[model samples]
Target: MWVNLGVILLQFLSGSIMYSYIIARILKVDLSKIRDGNPGASNLWRAVGWKYGILALFLDYLKGALPLAIFVSLGIVKDNFVISLAALSGVLGHAFSPILRFKGGKAVAVSFGAWSVLTKWEAPMLLGTIFTIFTIIKPKGTTVQEDAFRVILGYLFLLPYIIYKSFHGDFHLLIFYDGNFAVILYKHYKDLWGYLRGQS
Candidate 1:
């Protein structure tokens, strides 16, 4: 019981750290007044450059992946449930990082990292489709609203797969697995609502 509690606590702690903000600060960028008003890699990409964006993305991804790697290596979380929970911490971290006063990114990249470890090849397939769709549809300098649409379309593409896999297989391994994506969707709900209102 104590071991499980420890794992959960560590997950929360790991997920709460805001690495992107830290990177931004190191780069001498004030991320609180940027595009989307976020300290995420995307904002950092625009603030600094693509090189910084790539580096931030890598560090953000590694933060999640490294913790899961540690849990798997230490054998502290052998069950899929525990693994999923720990991985979700990274996504949650990206979404509501304590370092950023609980205001963080939309959790897309962190979730993608976690899914990559759990779902293997299918993970890249999902992420690639999202990237390709955005690249094709997004304008050269897309607004926040435009980016949100890309995100929604990316998620919509995976809806069928999520429903199919959850109902068709031993999906207990996916309890908090999809939570990462859901968190992102929840974060961007406001943008979605605006889009709906405009359509009507």
Candidate 2:
């Protein structure tokens, strides 16, 4: 039990470290003042170019994936529920980072990283496929409102699998899924609301 908490705490700390913000700062680009004030990888692309943006993206994803990978690989944490907790902790950390005064990114990249490792890449592949399909229909360069809507919609589409797993008695997956979905919805609620009001 204590070991599980330790791993979960470590994952949260790892996820809380904002690589994108750090990279942007290193390049003297204040992300909070530019491109929706997001301090995320996409804004990095606009401010510092694609190379740094990609780098920050990779690092953000890696921060979530790598620590969990090491724990799983080294046999430090083995229980499915514990792993689920740790995975959700990672995404939660990014969504509500203490390092950033409990404010953080939208938790997209970190969520992908954590879920990719937790489900052996199944979750990420499913989400990527859904997101790609949605992106094709909607396309980028539209607005952040659309992007936020698409993200939540993509996660909503994953709910059936999580429910299916729970029905099959794999409850840990459901726990992680619920926690992740909640964090994402909370983080993007403003944009989601904006999208809805604009459409209405």
Candidate 3:
């Protein structure tokens, strides 16, 4: 139990670093003043160029992936619940970073990292495929708002698969799923609310 708690705490702190935000600041780009006001790779791409954007994206992704990968693979955290919490910690860290004054990015990239390490890359692929389809379909309702809705929708779709695999009745996966979904929904709530209002 103590080990799990430690892993959870470490993962949360790890997730909270906000590497992309740091990268943007180092480049003298104020993400808040940019389009969509997102302190993430997307805005970095717009403010700088693809090289920096991709670099920021990779670092943001690594923060989540590397830690969980080390902890899980090394058998440092074997409990299913701990594993789930540890994975979600990375996502939550990026979503609610303390260093960023608790105002963090939406955590799309970090979510991929968490899922990638947690499910041995399965969940990430599923989520990525959904993202690809959404990209191809080119959904409407403004870019950020539409993307937020897509994320919420994509996770809803991913739930069934997680359920399908977790038929053992262990709720670890569900815990991570629910928590991650809540963060994503919460982070994008503004855009989501605007989208809903517009539709109405």
Query: What is the number of backbone collisions in each predicted candidate, taken in the order shown?
Result: 1, 0, 3
Residue 150 in candidate 1 has what lDDT?
A: 71
| Pairs of colliding residues, candidate 3 | 15-93, 15-94, 16-93
Candidate 2: segments with Cα more than 4 A from true spot? none
* Candidate order (TM-score): 2, 3, 1
Off by over 4 Å in 3: 139-142
Which candidate comes out best when scored by lDDT? 2
lDDT of 2 by residue, 111-166 (tens): 88988877777778888888798778766465788878888988988888878878
- lDDT per residue for candidate 1 within 46-124, as digits (tens), equals 8889998998788777666656767777887677666677778777877888777788777776666777656655855
After superposing all C-alphas onto the true structure, candidate 2 shows an RMSD in angstroms of: 1.6
How does candidate 3 score on lDDT?
0.82
Candidate 3 residue 143 Cα shift, in angstroms, is 1.4
lDDT per model, in order?
Answer: 0.72, 0.85, 0.82
lDDT of 3 by residue, 17-116 (tens): 8776788788887999987898888889878888988988888888777676787889887888778878888888888788888788999988888887
Stretches > 4 Å off in candidate 1: 198-200
**C-alpha RMSD values across all candidates:** 2.6, 1.6, 2.2
Q: Candidate 2 clashing pairs?
A: none
